[model samples]
Target: MPSMHRKRNKSLGLLELIAIALGGMIGGGIFSVLGISVSMVGVFTPIAFVLGGLLALLAAYSYVKLALYYRDEGATYSFYKKTFPKSRLVASIVGWWVTFGYISTLALYAYTFASYAISGFEFANSEIARKAVAGLIIFIFTLINVWSVKGMGKIEDLMVYTKLIILVIISFVLINNSNTTIPKILHNHEDINILSIVIVASLTFVAYEGFQLVINAVKEMENPRKNIPRAIYSSIFITTLVYAIISIGAILAIPFENIIQNQEYALASGAGEVLGNIGAELVIIGALLATSSAISGTLFGSSRLISVIANDGYFPKFLTKRKNNIPVYSIITMAILTFCLILSGNLVVILEFGSVTFLLVSLLMAYTNFKIRKHTHSSLIVTLLSAIGLMSGTVAILYFEAITKVEQVYYIGGLYIILTIFAFIFSYKRN
Candidate 1:
């Protein structure tokens, strides 16, 4: 991975890089988070999405600066280690935090994939059925990724582009067929406040996370200084538009009660009542494609990160071994943990856990970028604001969890405690 220029006969261009970012970001984004956002913010859902996008762009600014300076595919973990070389414990902790964050997202995508894939079935709401389907999808993607990296890339290209079109059409069709206007929605939900909307925005941070996957391709792309910013910024901008449009359409067309009731498959259930079967079918297809590609891309990218960490001796050495250039142990280990997360929590719990994990991790990245702003050519104000925004987002999530479901926060806190213990032991052994 060191000789990045010698990656392939043809390095990734801006278009392919954008496709990867969009694929990663869009996959588990709208389809998974929309219902929850709507539930929390009512007619203000699009506003939350816009706020979330702004936060994403802020986080991206720091990521791009660090990426241009480092140019390593190890990405978040690698950047942190290089920035604070002597702080082995913090670096080891960051590696663990980021890797587990990916696992939670993999679980999020698979959970959404199952919800939409079986939305039309008799057992759609069955907990057992949902988990079984989620696990099955994970199994299928795991096999595809390990069998051939080239094959996985091609499938990714197809799904990424096709899902975008489907999602656009679904959003337009929903808005065109809306039963109520935004004004009426506003009149009914007049009590909603800015703080609530911002909380939802913070909780929805997980949806914008895949943009970092672009930096993970540093070794596969050209001109890191140029392409990293271009690809990540462009993808997030485009995705923000996509999400805001979808949020507008969803709130306009889908009844809040129905969306809240069917939270997991909100679009599927509501699209059916609003536009009949044709619209529902469109949403299901788009969601399946979105989540499928997301699961594949995440598993592929995160496994490589695991391989890097294990090679650094933070994890079991066997995870660094590969067969046919595939990190088989790392990939399988991630999938199993993803299923475990799904089994342990419901949709909201998983979503909150993932949202909090990524925000904290990105916050750490922002702090690291600020610590060496001169070397990264980063501005003082932008880096400070980025850290502040990420910190606020993390605090907002904890506040939301504490307000709505206090026990959920304890569960998430316990999980972090376990991860911290693992990170400590790993870093201690290295000493």
Candidate 2:
């Protein structure tokens, strides 16, 4: 049985939860993945985004069900504990891996913002200037998080609202200016198959991973059981619609070939091409806001994970200590790790490895759902569905890893397994 010793300050409202979800989901992936997605699926890139959203919705449903039943602070960790008491060590490993993945994602978004800001300036050709700007941005945000999570949350709420308004405006503009016939969706496509769609869609689906972070906020939610589900589903629905319209407009504004060539900021470039310099600037600002909001939210959530782990006796008890009713040490630890990762300048590799770790954790979560159904005699239908959804998503990610030849996936997977073994060995000896 998992014990909840510390009570959380449940001050987050539905808007805050929604802001976190939106902030996490709409990070740099939206700006960065457009070219790659276009390359993979052609004009059907928008369709791939919608498909990713549906799959994410499925995962969210599973999480909602588990949250309602378990109501534990550990999120996935607690779910696994209820289902596999003896496998507590494995659950802890999964939880840590998940936290690490989100941290890597934060690094990726920070790097993306640096890349965009550098490219926007006349002195962008100066390598030293570029690095300095990137480092300064990371440092500023790290300080923001270390100083106060609640303060960061307030900033994120404002940032998220601004980004949402921008997306809505962009979508409205696209719909109003759509001169191309809708038939081009099918008529322009030359080839479409399961393999191609999944290959292309996986990139866009990465954006949808933001929904997972909402579960971390459950402890802070006033009424998690009801609010979490509503927020998750509603955010997904709105983001999906926005992504589809923006993607299609981007493709129509710029030729598919041109979009593929500008791999970095395809959406912004397309916006610039169609809507001119002002539109491009708006999108760029949106990108910055999106990335900053993501970093803030991840810092908040990952600190909670650290606090949970410490409370479980995995680390020094100091990590569990709270100041002003907040886990100060845990938050600082997360900021330090993120700062170190920013220095590596290997943000892309970190993201791929992070995705691999996350996939493994998701797989474990699904398995836990399945095991819970078998052991506790609870409703099996949703659990089974959740397991299937997680498995499908995981398999897709693995396939993506292999196809992309990201060798880091194998190394990360092997290292995590080794760590899991060692953690258990130490636990056994200590006990």
Candidate 3:
């Protein structure tokens, strides 16, 4: 077999690839979703975390096959375009939706970062202060990404590993301080059903969305076929364990209402109660590190994706400009859009949008993999099951929106329509 290694001026190794995925996955996702998951299903939040990991694994199956087959830095858009070259519409839809998906997540991570960063201050919950801080962090990371990818990767490694250690320690401390056990909590709560767990698990899919960041870094990585799957799977598994442990600790130690009330910074607040100022401070530090790296990683990989799409002519050609192999304009564009979203300051809606977009995109990816399963040597049954899993996630989100926030469903629907229109216009112009 020919070596899959590609000689380049610089390359990222298996560890770095894993860092990118972990950095992306561990961002505001856990911080933001922990409270909601716990509220929806108290003692079983850890179970939901494991189920979420399973769903992520299923999604990664198709992404790994497509990444190996195409080896295109474009990732989602590139995979779909190459798979169905004749359909400009398909390319356009995937391109716009996926790019915007990253943008929404960027906004999310920054917002979550702001929440934690300001949590120590008297004005922590102040909306204006939070948005201002969020915008600042986004600008700071955009500059860091523009400076260099290697530099960004190093920072990501430092932050990701450090936070993982902090998270594990905090989990242990919280669990030890708890007066209750999982069995006690479970036995006391009889109303929690399997269906509720499944629903929350589906919602947890957003937490696992970052594994694909590895694929987006194909151009910078060594032996992608081996490293891509290794990095993605390993990161997801590690993340699952981290999430499960911490979530169990939080649920066990803190009252459910406290978690729900301080949903944005639940862990930190709960830790304060369980372990006093030191414990709260420790969780805050972990969150700050987690969200910080996430913002950096998302900007680093997604900017490259934007450049790839622009170069393909689906987006403005001027966005293809690069300096020292950096997509400066693309990075700026993403940062500005993300800042705007932060200014809007609709956390739940933004979270729902990001999760829904990725779920739909993953579903499409599964179908694409199934279409060329023979060439990719993919398992027919697994690909089909992946589609089903992704579909169930989409359904779960839509159902939640319909019952609690019907207006958000309409808002998301309207945004999709607008995105589809832009995709069609650009794709048609390519002719």
Per-model TM-score, in order, reads 0.96, 0.86, 0.97
- Candidate 1 on 246-336: residue-level lDDT in tens? 9899999888999989989899999999989988999999999999989988888788889889999899999999997678999999999
lDDT of 2 by residue, 1-431 (tens): 12322234456778888888887777745665777778877777887888778767766665666777777656766677567767756756665666667767776677666656765677644546645665666667767866764677688889999988887787667556565655776687767677677655544555776776677777667677678788889888877876888787776666677677656556566677777788878877877887778777776766776777667765557889877656778777776666566676454455556555554566566666655554434467766665665566667767877777667566656756765765575345434
**Candidate 1 ranges with C-alpha deviation above 4 Å:** 1-11
Cα lDDT tens digits for candidate 3, 247-357:
888888898889999888888888888899999999889998998988888888888899999998889998899997789999999999899877764777778888899
Candidate 2 residue pairs in clash (backbone atoms < 3 Å): none
Candidate 1 TM-score versus the reference: 0.96
* lDDT of candidate 3 at residue 295, scale 0 to 100: 85
Provide the lowest-lDDT 10-residue window in model 2: 1-10
- Supply the TM-score for candidate 2: 0.86
In model 2, what is the error at residue 363, expressed in angstroms? 2.9
Clashes of 2: 0
